[model samples]
Target: MFFVDTIELAGLGNRSYLAGGAHTAVAVDPPRDLDQVIAAAVRRGVRISHVVETHIHNDYVSGGLELARVTGAAYLVPAAADVSFERIAVHDGDRVEVDAGLALRAIATPGHTPHHTSYALEEAGAAVAVFTGGSLLLGSVGRPDLVEPRLTERLARAQHTSAHRLAEELPDETAVLPTHGFGSFCSSGQAEGDHTTIGKEKAGNPALVREVDTFVAELLAGLEDVPAYYAHMGPANAVGPARIDLTPPAVADADAIAARLAAGEWVVDLRGRVAFAEGHVAGSFNFEAEGKVATYLAWLIPWGKPVTLLAESPDQLAAAQRELVRVGIDRPAAAAVGGPASWVRDGETPVSFPRATFTDLAKHLGDDVVVLDVRRDSERAGRHIAGSVHIPIHQLHKRLDDVPAGEVWVHCASGMRAAIAASLLDAAGRAVVAIDDPFAAAVEAGLTAVPR
Candidate 1:
């Protein structure tokens, strides 16, 4: 009996699988582990026949190209998905055979994405297994907002229709394998940290349980915000790249990294925005972690040029390499080799953080501080301190004259983006303090403005 190996991505909390191998293997929605997928294929003495993406992935950079690179395998995407890679695009009822009597059929499952497809493996055209990518997670359905926005009525209509097709067309005994796991943002209703059976999913997954109208309504209403960068990433992925196997890039020390930055090479600080805000290599662009990391890095930063990283640790260099490869940004000019210490030791001018605790913030507010709220309008409207000036971060460059000028205190929800803005402002000859807690600082100053 052939068995499946489910490797949980502990950090990202998604699941990837190496299913049915000896002579041939197929990697299913590889979750940021190109080496692991290659190793599994090699260990089983199998040629990775195909690398399948469950959908246009949002959680991590897709490793379809990486797997295909290592094994000389075919990378396949859905026919209608707006992707641009050299992939075998298959539609409904199309089949890719791995071996005799072991073929995967692409069943067009368009809801989570317009081009989303699920696969069914059959021995002699009798289905034995199903790889439900994002369309069906263990105990949840994929959110339909990757291509569509805000889970509109059309999105609900599509989702409910997709679910109905899965529930009706598939067999009960078919082994259910999903691309996303408990912690993947693709699902909000997955079983508590465990994969769900398709039969069990049909019984319990909320998106599957409700009638068509209600199902769409529930799916639309419950989903949290998908990250902003994905708005650009999904379309770019439609075109394929040369496969990306994350062989680590050559490392360079802090001085080399600085030289690269000086030569107009983009320096991507892989730290959290808060950490980067507190201190970072000055003039480096801050691209924080989350879904669409590589996509955004590829989009925002210049490609084919050098990209040095300000990583968290030695272990994280591999992660940074993987992120770069996901969107085909593989080459680095130089990077921080011994972490941040070498840079501090070199005295290359550190970015200092003057972040204050709530008490420290309160003390400063009493000294005639002008509060600068530099968040989006939605963020500002939700829960902002009264009497704070509404100058969004993006517009801070042009609207400096609009902001009340004496001893200005700039703040965002957290302090990083605000700090960056404040630094830019400081260079422009403004007296600014980057405030971590704008609301508390505002109240402490006895600033008064009644709610509108």
Candidate 2:
């Protein structure tokens, strides 16, 4: 019996699969960090025979080419995906035998991209599973706007048709595994859980249930801002992503770290929000290593800017580096794995900022305090503090000058982003108070929220 091992990219909410037969396996939609995929193949005791990409990804760097080169696997890509690379260009209804009695039949499932393809796996001529990369996700389809704005509406309609095609063609029991929409922004809207079946999606997927025009309108309207780095991903993937270098980078001393900081490079602190708030480098930004470090840092940091990482342990530093590399941030300028106390021993004490809850911020509301809401436009539009000024976390670095000089109280839906914003404001020599509580607590705190 053939089985599929799902390798999850938690930060992006994407999944890659290693489907193994008796002696061979196929890798589906791998990220640039390919070691995990290799490990899975090794565990299954199967030689990776094929590396398949559903499309030219716009969200993260793909590992297909590198993985193929390393494993001697046949690299496979969609026929319509324009790329300057060597690979088997598969079209609709193309079947390739991966192992004895195990074959992958490519189904042209466009919409996520014009060339998007899904692979339906079969064992002894019976449908076993379908790897639906972005076209058909848990309960919502992949957002079509990532490719081109002009084609967004048309592609969305295609997405609806693609979801139905898969549901109609594949057996009800066939496992439906998706590469996007666990928490990914690539999803048209929210969906539940990590996995589902074709029958389950057919019965409940919002996109499949709605008319094409209605689905397109709702999907386009619901999309949040695409990450700035996404513009680079599609191009990088098309050419071929640079090979991931996992070798531990050099550790920087205080003087070198100071030099980068002085040069206006980003010095990212990967400690927890609480630890960072207690004390951190005077000018460093706090994006907790455990949270959405990849998504937020890649979105917020200036592209091609040097970044120095400060972490509590080697594991934390390594984890942060792995996340960064997946988004085409190949290397940090320098990294140190001890807290600020160890790194900042040159007579200058680390800085600390006050962290207030929603209730606390409500109590302190006055003329001298300026509430900065650092959430997405959708979040602000949904509901927010009456007088809070909106500048999403992604735009805060460049839009810092727009904020009036006062005691800036920063917050997002939760404390993580607030802590990050607070650090940025503090680094710029502004007085900041981070509100570290859930957004739901606003009403409970007696803070007036402008309802959506």
Root-mean-square deviation (CA) per prediction? 6.1, 1.4
Candidate 2 residue runs with Cα over 4 Å from true position = 448-452
lDDT of 1 by residue, 6-26 (tens): 766644456788776447877
For all candidates in order, the CA lDDT equals: 0.66, 0.89
Candidate 2 Cα lDDT to native: 0.89
Q: Model 1: which ten-residue window has the lowest total lDDT?
A: 290-299
On a 0 to 100 scale, what is the lDDT of residue 444 in model 1?
54
Best by lDDT: 2
TM-score, structure 2 vs. true: 0.97
Q: What tens digits encode model 2's per-residue C-alpha lDDT throughout 1-452?
A: 89899998989878899997989999999989889999999899999999999889888999999999999999999999999999999999999998999999999999999999999999988788999999889989888999888998889889989988998898988899989887787877766866689888888887778887887888888888898999999999999888888777789878777788889999999999999989998899999988999999999888999999999999999999899899999988889888887777588788899988888887788756999999888888878888788899999989999998899999899788898899999999999998999888987787756675
